[model samples]
Target: MPALQYWSFLVAIGVLVIAGGIFAGLTIGLMSLDETNLAILKLSGTVEEKAWAARIEPIRRNGHLLLVTLLLANTVINETLPVLMHSLKWDGYKAVLISTALIVVFGEIIPQAICARYGLQVGAFFAYPVRILIWVVYIIAYPIARLLDWILGHKHGVIYRRSELKELMALHGEDQEGPLTKDEVSVLRAVLELRDKSVLNVMTSLEHVFMLPLETKLDRPTMENIMKAGHSRVPIYASDRGCIIGVVLVKQLIINDPDDAIPLSDIKIRRLPRVTARIPLFEMLHVFEQGGSHMAVVYDSLPGQTEQPGESSRNGEALARIVQPTWTYASPRQADSSGGNVLGIVTLEDIIEELLGEEVRILGSTLRACVRVYMEITGRL
Candidate 1:
């Protein structure tokens, strides 16, 4: 063959190889972008059935096409180069070595590595174009996708599973470089807390609660005596503390004269709301929001169930009912009422301290468990 025709053929093969390599790199880049988009869609709960199907179908088709095209281009170049070298009277071994080195280093490794690392960034910049391509392919592939969907009994769109969120949380925890900072760890722990914490975790036990007998006459000296003891609201029970009738605000008592005989029924606030010990803390927040009250009365504590059974039941039930109810105090009226009856008085400050203490205890236990598990797994325990 003529020198120019031979050189032309070699140049064409080189161009084809380079083109295939670029497409391969772009395919890898697109896959990375797809993963990121899926992550965002999952997190935001915005992955519509159509959109998710549309998002993935084109990538799959293009990826398949790209793989075949690259393989064919690679084979053609690999075969053509040796023939070209032989015809040119060049050493076939030398040409093969140089071409392999060039393709591996420049065409494959460096370009693909760059694309992989910055895939999402490049994908974002090219999103408009890629989206157009995806749309075009989606239209063409719709029939096949629909057929597959029908056969597999797979629905289109984003269906949220609890497991997905758990996996995401676990992935986030794993991605942190070192020990997470206090705030970061607190946030992650708080996410986990949504599932774990219940009303019993933060409530005050009934033993420590100050309650007033419902039959007790709202006599001057009696109210005065309770006030002197520094209780704000006192739970008014019909016969015993367990039979709570309502909560009485001491401030309401102050509004009456010291010597005045105030009727218990008139002074007492009716319709006191009570939360079950098993209620989740997050759900309990809504109760606090609607009640326009704080300081909930926690009922009976079952015997032998305390974390420290030896401790008095009094302290255990008191500790259990002290949840910090979630409420947005947009104005002064929404603020916690000071000086209330002590069916159980849990101040915002008290709740904060309790939560902080619980977090510390949980973190300590978690760390110890992790260490123990690790040691056992490594046979170093």
Candidate 2:
């Protein structure tokens, strides 16, 4: 009977100690999860993918509940662990030492190490139980959650802001297990900045863009440029750049009206969506998608204001630009907002490149190889 009593206390200590580890591990695992990937999975994924996203979503959103649960539960177990060992009829000092070692090793170091590297896995394993635990603890922790909401000014389902995301990426750049390459890290940084980058910086200025008036007779030069239009799409203006009506597909010149090419006025013209120059590229993408247009007219400011090309445009040239301009020329760099020139034109390709990483153009074939070799030698890549 005495042996059974001792063993029962021993079992109690073991269970409580291990439970503490799980709680601690859960805290680390959920905290370290990649909320971005989880969100993508939530938006467009299979059933299993969506399930995983659903399970993890709460852990990311209700961080307050989990932290409170872990803190309170771990604290109680750590404090009670020694007392239970003493009840096993052991020496008081020996019981204290044993409890401390178990809590520190099993409950802290082991869980932290495992969770830090394999957080998503650890989080998945505990998500179901932790979700229930959160609900159960909600009654107990509601005040704390409310206090945090008051302090943080809650926004639903927003795990991290853009600035916080940048800091976190930088913090993990030096991770030892599977460090990201410099290029990979830089691309990730650019991705976070997409929402901050305005359309003005990336759009093709109206001057550089190929456009023609509705009433123009296809003169020899216009015919030549249309026959060899360097771009896929060309904007057609009614009277001036300000009166841009719709775009023409270069392929349409050859493909339409086999007898004698359809006139520019008769070409199928999709409605061109208007985007403010100040709108972030990422936000503009949503508008583009919803509008089902690959290209949008970008304004320098707002409607009825000066809409001129941005200073950063590669094709900036100051002029009236009313001359039968070739594809090589852009609008005047100094045009005022009232003149009706668009700040630039944003294409789907430009936004895609900005999101994925822009390609760096290298001049001279030999120089490209030289730069590659220099990067390898200097480890500057």
Candidate 3:
């Protein structure tokens, strides 16, 4: 029994070493396979059919290689062990059973559990070596890949897709652990906003927008009134909302005489940046940053739509009677749909307030403690 136990222990060590080697080989081979697949894709044409074929062909070839290698290695190891044990005068069946059990326990299960626990760290440690192996395999596989391509009568080059890059970005976000920080979540949300949100979602509605009439003269009282309004800039429009002449800064008004008969056209900053309602907010942010402007105007819905009169009706008689223009800005179209034509305005302050509100709710206990500490430290009740 003691001798049997010693033999079993030795067999277990041998099995673990062999299994580790196999694992390392497969890991290296899989890395090579991935590189080859990418190369094939890179050399293929931009056409969808060609690209798909290029990508799939390499995967199929590598998968076949992997299956064959695993099968052959397992067969050789299992058969040779039994034969060697028989020659050594050990009971063939008992030796084979002991070796197989050891392999399963020590070689496969235990090592795999350890690797799984520290997979990312292990992968990072071997990253440089794995990369070198991939580069070497790519060069070696190039001729074979070309030959296969020729035989298949397929295209020889690949064009990378932007969708693949986007997928990589999403995969990165998914792999991160736990809940994302506020800023990280915001950045990720901002990225998604590029595709989903249009300029209309971020823009101030036409009703809420302040504009100067092209014919209006900038006199003392007019300038004073504009100054008192607390807006840094105002848009100048022609006869209607559609013809936006330009934007005028309040500081520019200060530079000119208050009583000067200044036509809005003379003070108007021409070629003001404009974005359609359908433009994405992420793209609009870039436009805003580039143009040094903080505001955008959202247009009203198309004209001539009538509304039914009811309590639930947004444009009902009750609302029409009760709603005052001074309460909010309204578009002409909104007035037709409801009693008013105004969509809600969202300012930077509004966004900041909303974020702060959410943060306060989430960190209620921390905030309470912080306040208490501050009050105690300052000797204030």
Candidate 4:
């Protein structure tokens, strides 16, 4: 009878160990999936990926409950076998040693290694059974899970503010989170900042921006002056330099007879879109894309007492520029009160450069030819 009881304990220990292995593997396997990968997998991936996604979905949704259940079940089995051995007249210390060795080897080491290394393969293999286990166990586990949920409160997902997201990217850039490298994070950060960029960030200020007056004859010297200003696009104003109306490409100078008696007004061109200084730069890019135009005029709001032009604002400060589109220094009498001030000039190239956070090399053939002509005439390198 004593021997019979000993054999019974041995069989019970073996069964408990196998059950413990399933619990251990399920815990590690289910948790190993990244939520993003799982989501992507569900949305039209390969057959194997879709299969794994389907298998893992339920366990992932009920993760907390599944985890707690697995832990509770393992704990019960581990403790019960040892107590059962002692009940069969085995010594306490021997029972403890045997149980610990078996649990550690079978319950943790073997199962964890298999799941960790071939998680998708082995995990998908057992996913259905593990899923069934959760459902069966959830009936018992839900009350405690609900009570804990009530006490702690559940968040559907992480919410980050723009500043917080920047900080997180900075942290990842430093390699605190591992996989992401600094350069990659920097690109990501630049993209995030694109939405926040205003026309003021990229537009050439009014001071340096080249504006051709309608009264000025379209002569070689005037064309040279506009080209030397290092801008591919120039604004044309009527009589006053402050009242810009249309934009012209430098290439137009190369194609046209600079000696033509045509007034600057006769030059065929598109009117510039007027954009507010504070509007998002991305919106400007989108419009240029949809409308197929390159240049925009940036206007400014009334300067606050604390915030001045060419300096930082106390609220959402911006970099300084020469012109405030739709804003002017002229008195009401001198400047047309109806005509909004030109804050600055922004080109498609400027927005592209801003998006990439680097200057895009767009050397014009006309600009180069003009430079070569000047170089040959002066005989300087």
Candidate 5:
């Protein structure tokens, strides 16, 4: 080879080696960022990362096509390096040895390590060139890509299942120095799990709830009992204890005359939102958000029972027969006839407690009234 030709071939060999490395690095780096990862980065990543994700996503989405293109380009560049070295008047063995060392270290190892760490940034930077390369190899790559797609049934983006998400949260919780606190991780895990739970899982059974018969008088002793119960709302039942008609707010008793024997029926009750026991907590939460009563009467329908037209409320009793109500929130103005026997009372606090994964002692009207009464006696209120 002439003097100028020798130097030109040497430079060409150097260029080929560098090109091969970039192709090798991109195969691992760019392809490592699967479709799902790019989407998440596009949505919530940093400004730079978001831009990179957006630019790279179009190429990344066609996984098999991009994979074939990158691999083919790298092979050609690697093969060309030894040939160019042979042109520089180097012997076959010498050319092969030098090309192999150069391609392995500079082309494959270094580029791959760097690209693996900063794949998104590097891929975005070279996205235009990659697109052009894809076009250059379109004829060859398209057929192979289609074959792979046909065989493997196009790659679907992987997403974390609810159980997997919970496991991930648990793992994060175990990391003491992680951004998420243990409590936060617990709450996240609970949020993911809330859908699996039903009202039956967290409710105060009718027998255990502090309730009042509609016929009972709200006199001094009754007022004292109401204040001592520490419940924000008390279920009011008529005729049968199993037939809970509505709930009376403990705060309503503030206007009660201590000496007067007022009937509990005289106090207006907030109607309970009735829901089937099988309703998921997530849907139940939407019902609570719709306004009216946060507390719902959960009833289980008899086997083989389906929904009936129009709610049945004769007198003040909710129908003890099987009434399978739809997921819709029932009206709070009138008592909803639950077709089945009332199983339990589910309060808003119950759902909240489930979300927190801990028992939360909410300060009730009883505690507030006690504090106010003490303050009044001490002349502090």
Candidate 6:
């Protein structure tokens, strides 16, 4: 067996190989982490991850510099290995083979494998030493780093688009060990899509919405019908179905004597906010939040859109019985004069349903479901 002339030379060879491995590992590992990954970790990562990110961030920020320093150190250490092997009483050809095997297996492949999987932790642990290496190699590495920066321009961090974020959420949902459940991912994806949707997508069409004629009386039967309708608020129309006046709260009508029936005009009618169908759901939500109104009339404002000539009916039946008005409470903001054909009605529940990716149930929703079933059975919807 070929033996080394001095054991001290063998120790020097081991040190060089280890140093080469560290340099190779740092190059692949630390460089993989870009600005955005670091930022996300700092903000939402686990405690250990946050600490690791904080340690690595400052060093990784200067991408070109860190890259050049690590690569240069690794190259130099690899070059010195064969020379050290030759000095240890090894023939030139055997030394070359030995050095190549050591560099490929220990210095490159093994270290790179470990670093790729646990880069953040590894990089953080070696951050201080890497900083010192950068300083030591600054004179040579600085020029090359500057040239790269000038050629490539500064690196801009990754910013995900709405669709990209949805894809990412889907990926997370696929991971069994991930924090988000499938339903949670679906809801989050819906939230990101809210800015793309409008009231037109969620509104109950005008012909399907329940309303009351302004002249309708709150007799015992009518009160019972209104309660059975299950709406917290009901729109009041005047002259015709197109002429929506305002809305009256179901709770407000409870104080009236059922025996002594009162007209809708006799009660306080709150103004219904109006919105264009083209407005995004997010903007519509902001409108509802600011105005403190749970309901709004969706309208089509496109020029030359003609009004369909028919009284609005729900599920092939008139929701409110038409009778001559004893009194009319006409607000200046009535729907008929609002410069658009009423398309439908949208409520807070509609937006919430969109966000939740499911239909929301309110008090009278069960009755509405039955009505939908009835309509479907009769083929009137």
Best model per lDDT: 5
- Per-residue lDDT for 1-381 in model 1, tens only? 787888886786577556545545655765554433545544664445335534444444344333333344445555665565566666777878876775777567876887797654444454455555445555444555466556664433345465575555566666657555555555555554544565566766667766666556666557546644455566666655556556666655655543456666556454354444554555445345445665555433322222332222233243344333222222111112222233343322234444454422443244445434543554434
lDDT pick, better of 2 and 5: 5
TM-scores for the candidates: 0.55, 0.53, 0.50, 0.74, 0.84, 0.83
Please identify model 4 stretches exceeding 4 Å from their true place.
1-8, 32-34, 41-50, 109-122, 152-184, 226-230, 251-253, 302-340, 363-381
Ranking by TM-score: 5, 6, 4, 1, 2, 3
Per-residue CA lDDT of model 5 for 1-381, tens digit only, reads 688888888888888888888999999989899989988998999999999999998998899999999999998987777777877778888877888799889998999999999998899999989999999999999999999999997885778888998999999999988889998998999999887787789988878988888788987677767777777778888777777778887767756665577887777876676777776677667666655666878777544443242333332223322222322322233344535788988988899999998876666754667645843564434
Which has the better TM-score: candidate 3, or candidate 4?
4
> Per-residue alpha-carbon lDDT of model 4 for 1-381, expressed as tens digits?
478877887888889998898778777876776555577777978888788887777666655676777787877887788777777776878878887888999988998888887776676787787767767778778887777678776434345787888888888888766779877787778767877777778888888776877666666667567656766776777757677766766666555555563566566655665666765666666546644457777666433223232233322223112222322222221223343576787888887777567877656555766754764565432
**Comparing candidate 1 with candidate 5, which one achieves the higher lDDT?**
5
Candidate 2 whole-model C-alpha lDDT, 0 to 1? 0.65
On TM-score, the leading prediction is 5
- On TM-score, the stronger of 1 and 4 is 4
TM-score of 5: 0.84
Task: Report the alpha-carbon TM-score of model 1 versus the true structure.
Answer: 0.55
Tens-digit lDDT string for candidate 2 (1-381): 388888888888889989899888877777665566678778887877777678788776766666777777778888888788767777978877888899999998998889888776677778888878777777876678678778985544447778998877776676655568656777788888886787876888887877777654433345455544445567767757766666665544533333243455665655465656676676666555543556777764443422233322222232112111212222222222343446667787778778667632322233434434543454433
Query: What overall lDDT goes with each candidate model?
Result: 0.51, 0.65, 0.47, 0.67, 0.78, 0.77
User: Model 1 residue 224 lDDT?
Assistant: 43
Candidate 4 at residue 236, lDDT?
74
Cα distance off (Å), candidate 1, residue 94: 2.9
Task: Return the lDDT, model 6, position 313.
Answer: 23
Residue 270 error, candidate 5, Å: 2.6
